[model samples]
Target: MLTKRIIPCLDIKDGRVVKGVKFLGLKDAGDPVEVARVYDKEEADELVFLDITASFENRKTLVELVEKIAKNIFMPFTVGGGVGDIGDIRNILNAGAEKVSVNTQAVKLPQLISEASKRFGSQCIVVAIDAKLVTSHQSPVTSNGQGTDKWEVYINGGRTPTGLDAVEWARKAAKLGAGEILLTSMDYDGTKDGFDIGLTKAITEAVGIPVIASGGAGKPEHFFDVFSKTSADAGLAASIFHYQEYSVRQVKECLREKGIPVRL
Candidate 1:
């Protein structure tokens, strides 16, 4: 079995790490490079750096910051936000990112997913889907008949609703050559309640690619719950790690004790 990964997400805005509840009221956490260095030492399975406002502000991801973080950490690094085309993907990869995550651009021009995957290899392409739950009456049923409720994809830092079903989009992304799905539940993001297990499982079953469950992780038990209750390959959290609420090693230890395979 594949060991479940614990990833720390750095939501970057103006080149500094920030965290917000449900994608609003942002607060500075620390310098991106510094936080990344700490997680690197803590043996985090991977690191995700997202330029939260890059798409909204219409700018490329801070390549310099990515290079700085990459140089400081030895683990796999994934960078997202403001990746508009294949050129942008190449720039980020050359800057030392192991993977490039595309959201708004992929939704706007889905061909970008196929183009980037073909150019950079599907292993380097990740499709990030930020989704918010919608009532059954408001949205269509998921193509994968795993559930009754529905989720709509949100883009531009979760500010715009794209009216796309989350599970369907995951399936499409996989078919388009995306190697992985970074699914973040906007409703649970930063709430620390727990992951949206139902949504995670639905997408996991809908697509063959690995799914990294993001948002709503408060305690170590929350990570355990995600891996136990859903088929997600990874659990991602920001505030808990950024605020020193728990360490990566601590979470891994907890998971291992619970009989969950994790790198420790």
Candidate 2:
């Protein structure tokens, strides 16, 4: 039995953590370093830090913030945003990331995955995808969850929709040697409703690697529904954990109470 994981995500923009609805109306949460320290104390199973605007700004993830957050936390941490080549990967690792997450760059140049996997073990190469629903594109690349005819890939914090089928891209990333997939559902992002279970199930089933489900997670029970009802290996959330709506220990306890196997 796979022990389900509870992860807290820090969406960083301009070095500050922010939370918003469907990736809009961003509100300041706190310093990434401060929030990370709290999650570490709460015994979060894993931590994910995303420089939400790094790609948008067309630059590398803020190493200073990454260093600050990394030094404060002791658990496994994945840092992403605007990571392009081996040098960027090396710099992030040197700064303290346990894993380097690539999104826009990987999608643009698939070879980056193979190269990174070869340099750092596949386990350390996490491919993060930002996807949204579309309606007109037989395969419309979606940037955000505003609306659409097809599911598309968006880069730079859901600002540009890459006309590509998210499902197909998941498979391709895995084939290119991605070890884990961190998928965020733009449609469900910041909803506090629940995960897009259908999307979670799709990527988890399509890819052989472990899939980290992000975007929508409201209550502790929602976490249970995600792990048991879908193929996701881990449940990732931001506002819920960031605002202290629930603690990692509390979530794990709830999962145990619900008869879902967890590390506790």
Candidate 3:
């Protein structure tokens, strides 16, 4: 059986780790390097650093942060946000990112994926989609509706809503050459209730690429619930692991007891 992966997400803004609710009211978490090193020591399966604020020339800043963390972390690391083009991907990979995640930029120009796959191989490209829930009433009354009930694609720290269908985007991204999909539920983010299995399962079935279920994971049992109920390839979380509220080893132990395969 393939070992289940547990990934820790670091949402960086202005060089600090921050967590917010439903992608709002952000709070400072800690230093990126510090948190990353801790996760590395704890033997996290993978580390993801995202600069939620993706506008402006964020590439330089992100590369520097990646360098800092890479110096101390031995595990696979992924860096995302504000990646403009193939050049940016090379820059990030050169800076030590094992993988580069693209969101807004990919949405803007999907050919970047094909061009990118040619340049760096398909496995290096990951498409990260930020999604919220949309209800029946919120639909075609226009598939794009108003308020929190809508599943809008948020970029730039939840400030930009692309009004694209999350499910459709996931399929399109895979067809465009994305090796994996990092799907995060904006609704359950930071709430730690557990992952949004409905939304996650939808994407998993919609796309052939590996689906990493993120958002609302508050406990190890949550991982079991997500994987058992749905085919999400991995579970990614933040607050629970960052605040020392949970550790990678502890989560893995709990998962093992539940008969979920994990990397100890």
Best by lDDT: 1
The lDDT values for all models are: 0.85, 0.80, 0.80
Candidate 3 structure, TM-score to reference? 0.86
lDDT for model 1? 0.85
List the candidate numbers ranked by TM-score, top first: 1, 3, 2
- Which regions of candidate 2 deviate over 4 angstroms? 19-29, 55-61, 136-150
Model 3, span 140-223: residue lDDT tens: 223222223345577655568888888888988899889889998887777778888777877888888888999889988899
Q: Lowest-lDDT window of 10 residues in candidate 1?
A: 20-29
Please provide, for model 1 over 19-121, each residue's C-alpha lDDT reduced to its tens digit, 9 standing for 90 to 100: 6322222242357876776788889999998886675343443887788878887889899987888878898899899999999999999999999999889
The most accurate candidate by TM-score is: 1
Q: List, residue by residue over 17-133, the lDDT tens digit for candidate 2.
A: 777412222242366766666677777888987776675353443777768777777788998877878888888888888888999899889999999898888888999999876
Candidate 3, residue 94: CA error in Å? 0.8
Against the true structure, what is each candidate's TM-score? 0.89, 0.85, 0.86
**Per-candidate RMSD, Å:** 4.4, 5.4, 5.5
- The candidates, ranked best first by lDDT, are 1, 3, 2
* lDDT for predicted candidate 2 compared with the true structure: 0.80
